[model samples]
Target: MTSSLHLPRRRRGLNRRQALAALGAACALAPGAADATPEAARKLLGDLVKVAPKAGKVKIDVPEIAENGNAVPVTVTVDSPMSPTDYVRAIHIIADRNPQPGVASFMLGPDNGKAEVQLRMRMAESQNVIVVAELSDGTAWTATREVKVTVGGCST
Candidate 1:
């Protein structure tokens, strides 16, 4: 009997450079292409959560000044009972000046015991950082803090 060998199939998609070029073109043609400022990011966050204001309780912990922008520590804490009836459903972190304003989004459950999350991320420049918390009761709360970066993380 003749031995049969199998070869792995190559991915039929654009390579790295081609993918980047496609992404750049898409971003250039997207709406509000010139409005990637901090204010715009905040407004986008507000619209995403679908909350006006004064809903749940949220807080953000971060240093006022960062020596390095490559990795800044951030923590979000929500004041909620975390019971079956009421609990924090999700937490979203946004870095204003980053190429992608949306930094991190975390999902929580009552088993988490506490509504808190900590992470380190890169920041493009000095700007306001927003933290939004969504509760099980369909309410959302937000908090923001300005962070000064001595060194830039994103490309100039």
Candidate 2:
């Protein structure tokens, strides 16, 4: 099966070495691109979109203790009817202590039949994770979980 990776495409002009060099140079220019912070995340999220979320009706699943910080499994579920009249619109995962608070985002619809998402998240350190769900009816739900990592990920 030919599946899309959903990764960024390499720029047309630069070769592998040149691309790597350019990427390195660009990262150097962007402050904290190597290490994202919660404040940075707040600013990032604030610029991306505004959200007012309520509590409950959502569940976040992650290990209480992660032996490795490189990759931690995370799952989010929302209690929704999954019908055209009532369905989930999107899910955004945030890590409180990680350099970048925003982790992953998923968009869903009635065709999904359920509101659920599973993915692996790289953590910089032990931190609390928050998941915000947006519904088609213009309502938002949130849930949070804390995970302790023995070792940190990202620029380790």
Candidate 3:
């Protein structure tokens, strides 16, 4: 018996090459398929803070090689007095290669009594993770660490 699923060559939607090309184009244009760049991560930080963040005073504690990108442990600490006048106002975690560069943002105050933030972040691939700490005085500090992921977890 002839199968109804079978279609003649003339009735085929696209040839082999055309089908492949269409697939490639679709993958390229797919949402969340594009990975974020380091420049984009930096631009996100720039948009958050007016002044250029200087390196140091902020420490990023993360594994040099993350076994899995699904949940990579990260700890960000800022050297601050934690006083009412001078304290860390915010801490932003950014994964450069993720679909979304901004991972998490923690808002802190003197009452928190510490300038440390710990969380698990999803990394798209092997790339830099940037941590920016903004102080109450409008000063910003940054720290970057490279984490190599064996298995990428992000949709990108």
Best by lDDT: 3
lDDT of 2 by residue, 1-156 (tens): 123333233333346769779855653445554545557655655544466778898998889999888889988999999999999998888887665567888999999998999999888667788888888988888888889988767454
Candidate 2: regions farther than 4 A off:
1-37, 43-49
Candidate 1, 27-58: lDDT as tens digits:
44445445557776877787668876464488
Distance (Å) between predicted and true CA of 125, model 3? Answer: 0.4
Error at 155, model 2, angstroms: 2.3
Sorted by TM-score, highest first, which candidate order results?
Answer: 3, 1, 2
Where model 3 places Cα greater than 4 Å from the true spot, the runs are 1-30
With a 3 Å backbone cut-off (N, CA, C), the pairs that clash in candidate 3 are none
Clashing pairs in 1: none
Minimal lDDT window, size 10, model 3:
1-10
What TM-score, computed on C-alpha atoms, does each candidate reach? 0.73, 0.72, 0.79
Instruction: Flag the better candidate by lDDT, 1 or 3.
Output: 3
Best by TM-score: 3
